[model samples]
Target: MQGKKFGTFAGVFTPSILTILGVIMYMRLGWVVGNAGLIGAIMIIVLAHVIAISTGLSVSSVATDKKIGAGGVYYILSRSMGIPIGGSIGIALYIGTALSIALYLIGFAESFNGYFGFGLTINDIRLTGTIALLTLTCLALISTSVAIKAQFFILAAIIISIVAIFFGNSNFQPETIQLFSSVDAVPLEVVFAIFFPAVTGFTAGIAMSGDLKDPKESIPKGTLLAIGTGLIIYIGVAVFLAFNVSSEVLRTDYNILMKIALFAPAVLAGIWGATLSSALGGILGGPRILQAMSIDNVTPKIFRKGRGKNNEPVNALFLVFVIAEAGILVGELDVIARVVSMFYLTAYGFINISYFLESWANPDFQPSFKIKSWIGLLGFMACFAVMFKLDMLAMLGAFAIIAGLYIWLQRKEVRLQSNDVWQSVWENVVNKGLKKIDANIDENLNWNPNIILFSGESKHQSYLLELGKTVSGRTGIVTNFKLILDKKNNKPLKKVDQIVRDDTFAELGIFARQVKVDNIYNGITNIATTYGFSGVEPNTIMMGWPKGLENSTEYSKMTETLLHLDYNLLYLDFDRKKKFGKYQTVDFWWRETDSKNAEMMLNIARFIIASPNWNKTKIRVLFVNNNNVNQEIISSKIRELVEDLRVLVDIEIINNAVEQKPFYTIIEEYSEKTDLTVVGIPNYKIEKQAEFVLKTNHLFETIGSTLLVKAANNFNVLDLDFIEIK
Candidate 1:
């Protein structure tokens, strides 16, 4: 089954014109002239239309380049600004359009009562509005084509109304023009609020974008035409009413259109047509917006259920009808108008902002029709300025509504893939930050770690990644390097292996990479020094403790190369088969009493505790008093250091092991129960090479996981020299 597609004239222009020549034009334009006069009303029309035109331009620019599906403004916005913003605007626009139905219905009911119900009560007006609402809604539900065809007759009636006004009014006296309402003489902002919706009706056509055969072409053409036509009509009405209608007649009698008409019945017909058409436009367009939003998962998908034979959004139409009837029952047309205006203005402001970002910042936003950045900026500023001036409470409420929707959608995390406007903004911000960092590269206090870790297969890779993340705290890039020795000639490692490794690391919230090289030693040396941007190169290299290092010289050569490059090297050894307990325990063994290892180990443990998995982990600052020299003094020293560093840890003095016992034996006996053990590797001279390797081998051979940390000159930790340990 194929859905009906509409062209520019029937799809865009007719609906747009009918909605534009709406209740505001017939009912409020004269009142606007009575208050703001010819010049003020013209200013209001021009200003409002400027926003509309700019938004139309922005819409056109974006629509032309992409195949706009459903969702209209929501679709365009979400696709351009990501789901959160788009969903927010979509919901606001939907409600605004839905409210418009009641707004128009009430206007029609008022005019109809004025013409026929000479002395009717408020109930009569509500009854009439309800009937009209149901009537138009039925027309809309029947099919969009039926509703659109009905707009043609409404269009004729509107033209006839305009003609009747021009021919019938003979009281032209430019000098007797009223500059303010004789009854109240309201503020300019209030008057602007009344007249602004006249131009906003163009979005009704925009909301029907999904049904349009060529939204890219139709939206720009039909929208601009409707805006231009509406502007002409409003300006003419302002001029006509200013020179002709008395200030008393304009202010006291809101139904000034019927009084000035050549045939009052034709004026009533025009009023009914305008209101009904506008109501129909809202009914037809509002549901489509909701349907599109639903399809995109911005709203409940149940709304996406009811597409009639003609592809009319049947479910969405019903939803819009219910809301509109509720508004009719309220019968507070003025308040609804202000709220509807506020939401439309807010939507326009975001549209302008989206365009401004696209034109000025986003390189991907290459539109066929170019819009100046200043135009979008001016539109954005004008919208909020007018909104706040018109009704600060309503403006704030509208923003609150949008904000609430934004937060809700963000929480939902609706995943839709598109190059959003924010991505460009973020990229520019990142570029600026990188440049600033590059310029301040020489400052030691400004240095942040950029770490590269040598990873093995999936099983061993996670350990290295976790430790790297612990040290880097995710602020710095932690790249997992897998160097595969090309033992089989021209037979590369399966790409799936690299993919699996990358995915596993990603699940742990880390980045990973695999490189096939002839040698792991040379690969590590080359990759570490040249892994990142100039100022952001890997300052630290992390790896799991190498197995059988006594049989290979790779570790010694790599350590020398790393030291020469001024990079801090850290190696971790952990029992992969072991499952850690709640409140993970970390044992930081202060072997050398040097600040380098003390700072590095403390920093790593600090980061680990920050993780949810290890948030309550207790740090044991174990002081091994092998010589049995002042155990109380050493415990006191560790306590002061822990307190000075502002870390919560228990100070333990290892008195069970004597100087004759191996350090590994002491570690195995004391720290085997803990989740992690941290020991600082002493800076080994060339003569103490065998001793250094032996110590590393013994530590790696321990039952618990161990981190062997060696800090460079760049690593900054708290100074213990100033603290007086009693």
Candidate 2:
């Protein structure tokens, strides 16, 4: 899927057409100083090229990495620093895309007004902008493949118009060589302003670098080519206008291309074509950044949800258009442009800073293309220089948005971490701690062997009957049988609760009692903790070892909690009914070394042997030999300790005659005949060995036929709260 998509993107967005026109228009210079006066038009062109090369170099240096994503330059910058910085850059990129959309719409409206006397009011302009936005939105709603194809057509029209404009006006040159002299008419400030717009499209090509075939080679070539083409077009137009047309005519209107189009038939078509092409470009690129940001969790997840048939982020594209229409309503093109520049500048400044910092910190962080560190330094300065051009209110508004987002993210991250930590701490302090208290009380007071049955609405209910007949003390069964009603779903909680109650009552007859709780797992833990704290610990906690689902985190955590509370767990491993009258072979696998929690497993094993089923089952203890002298000594001690049970059970210690992995050997030899295998819980540690044992499939897979026993320090059997049987 990934390979196919890349192929399509590569074919459509390679920098072939864009490079030719990127530097030509000098829109910025024209906008600032209509004709560039006659003095600095040449200088402005030269300076624009210099700026273009430097900016392209900066971008390419970062783009060389194969890991670059849709966020393009911004993603690279943020990842190099950290999430906080990356998140800030992400916001800037989104704003930049949005502002570009607005700029395109403004240009679109102006050009349409010039060509067709639509007599658009401020509201009418806004409506038209909205319409344009919706059109683009629909285009974007289609798959990415369709959008790229559309861009190809837009590029084609732009190239054709540009070619005609230049060819048609070629014959209209001035006579005198002196006519080619530098324009003194254009002001430096005006020239700079005009040159700014030309630079806008240079970065447009780089925006799709993530979607490019090879960003490193492609971005540099495409960016340079685009800027070069744009430069030539701008200079040619400026030169033609300076000699053939008067400065008075240029000053009257900022649309030099449209003005030229009036006299020369070819120029008019080119003017319209360029405007439409630029507008389409904005539409094609904007929603992609939004989709990328959404996937990264910097924005709402819905924006990153499944794409429509056209492979576009339909929801995001719709949103961009809606916002663009709002911008058109205001009809303040300068405001929109400045804001756009401000956002891009902020993002670019950070990118430069991040690169500089990363280079300083890591010696290995070199790119294929090297820009003198000074270029990035200059890039930083350039961004700040442009940023200051924005009005105080706009700057303040931008800052406020950034600050608000940062605060919200920080709070959310803190809350999530805190919740996880609190859960862990609470389970240890209450559940495990209370069980110890119950154990101490039970030791002092004479109490019958209490049996706690964990059952649900399943076939495992027969164990309850067997326990009822054998146990001579207080017996209680617990199950997670409740209907949770969501108010948003418009379901009555009382009705839902009644249904659950009726169903559970019907299943268990009069013997079983249902306990209603908010969350099943937490409820069970809470009840067990309460009972243990009250000094009433059950002798045996009878529950089925829910087969096929032991790998789940919830089950593991619950099992760990039970082990920690020192509950003698009765894990009924019955998958189907078998002859109950005959005794079956039971295999016990015990490790040599004893840890602090080892007693929990041993106690549970003893309780299982004491069960009614134990009388019908033959128990065999198989001890694997550990070579470590100290471990072997501990195993010997454990062996002597269990010798008292030899009268009632068969015990054997396997010696290491052949050296091999103990776990593998034990499972290979005894698993075939064993009805049930018993193993001890692992001691939790931060070391690699412990982690390997916990995560590896060897133990889990081998112990499939076995019931795992983990020892706990603070838990007592009396605290067992049975939650479910099925």
Candidate 3:
């Protein structure tokens, strides 16, 4: 279902009625008490209009490019400057909303007391405030349609009251004209104080920008209309009060509007009706800002979720209500007005600054109504001028809140940018490089053994048995087995695999364990790279050498590629033994070469020695000598490096002169007892020897285990996962 947009007239009327009727009465009461002259009143009204116009322009400009969410000001600002700035604005907006809520509750309580003619205690006011807040919250939660409907109804009441107030003042005598001429009679401070409330409703208009269907057209028009309407009403009411009610009576009574309303029987109803309508607007508008802020990620996302039916930020609304009700419990009407005024002034000043900077920063973003940048500059100056009138604590508190928000946004932006930079580098360089290398090395092999089994159909079951045997003693491996099925073709195999899982567990019986199975549609390489990055490093990989296919070029290439992977690639050859004995003998074939190459050999040997499975085995080091004069020197150097091994190390220095296929002779001698053979080559390239090693195929067909290491002069063993002799 689509949401209803704010109509043109409503867009203007809501803010207009909210601004004038909401707090103008309270402002006037303060002014009457302060005795601010005509000039002070005029200054306040002019300053307010300037502020209204500036805010309207800035807000409308933002609204034109983006959808205004419930997080009103914060959302618009955040969209303009990005999240960090948006967050600061959001927090400030929330604080302002909270303060406004509190102020309204205070006003509600004071007005209730004045009308009821009772000596209501703070607790009584608090109770009524809580009930009123809860009612508003309930209304907010119902639906946006309902809320807007309520807004329209309240605005109607406000308009009716304003009209009545204007009509009631038609009987103004000559004394009223004389009162206007006696401008010096009222003190300048009092008039300024009274006029401040007249401007309070401007923000209420600004807050409605999010809901307006055509904020660009409606917001500026509505804001100006609201301001104009508010001005007329405030001036009319103020003049009527000044003439009808005596200065002494108005001075002593803060509810001078209510008293003057009594003079004309119908005017009292309008005054009370306006008060209620204003309170309703305050309650309705404040939560939307909070919700918008949350949606922008400036606040918790939970608050942004809002109610499904209402599309309202119920959590934010409820929070506002609670805070406002609490403020009502502790504050009087004066404190509420002061705190609210202080917050609005500070926020409004920033609004002007934001607009000014935005205008200067992006001159292309011209508004429909372009006040000279100096107007905003002067508007901010005027805001600060009136801000000094606030108490020291209120001023400090307001600035402190804004300062905290700025610091928070700065920190947030730094972290956000740092994360973005890191992600870009990883994606553009690290991930890209690894993927390219992987693609070149083995496009067919699935390095990841976590999900997809690496071997073809004939070897799958045997490989599974080998995996089960390998992890027999390890408890941690029980739940880690993953069986990946090809989604496109393995529907039957998936069911069979599930059965295999059950049968395997049944066979294990008491050792019955858990295994994970995933059905995937992609090829092996994609699966491998995906899991490799996902942190699933398989301990052992098992596969089968195809019968009568071992000598095939394809088989050789596959074996060579698998060897390069550096994992324990156990080939389930039918000719090989299926099980291991208690003690195993391993052969370590070392060649005398440069000190650096020798170190690489030693590091590989040490890695084997540290292995839990291989450390207990006896290791034989066969140092082949091609009658090089420096053979002893190289042997001695290797001996020095291998001195720390606890296992028995046998070093055989075979003379190169008597060699009849050196690798063949060595393997024939050691193949009977050796479980594994590790060989090392000379660091420097020997062209004749290299060709012989590559073409002869002398040791290539050997049945026993063999590893041919092509040593480089400056090799770091730690960097190479596996050495490939290609």
Candidate number with greatest lDDT: 1
| lDDT per residue (tens digit) for residues 165-230 in model 3 | 544432323243223324445555555655666666655655666666776677667766776776
Q: Write the per-residue lDDT of candidate 2 for residues 258-354, one digit (tens) a residue.
A: 4445344444444545555565565655666667667667678887754543345667677667666667677877766656655665666666655
* TM-score: model 1 vs. ground truth: 0.76
- For 469-586, candidate 1 gives per-residue lDDT tens digits of 7667647677777687885527655766664344667776666777677677887987876777855667888887776664456767777888888887778776776634344788
Best by TM-score: 1
lDDT of 1 at 494: 73
- Runs in model 3 deviating more than 4 A are 26-34, 65-67, 81-85, 117-119, 167-187, 243-246, 259-268, 333-337, 389-393, 414-726
Query: What lDDT is obtained when candidate 2 is compared to the true structure?
Result: 0.53
Name every residue pair that clashes in candidate 1: none
The TM-scores, one per candidate, come to: 0.76, 0.51, 0.52
lDDT of each model, Cα atoms only?
A: 0.77, 0.53, 0.53
Deviating ranges (above 4 Å) for candidate 2 = 3-35, 46-51, 169-187, 253-265, 308-311, 389-726
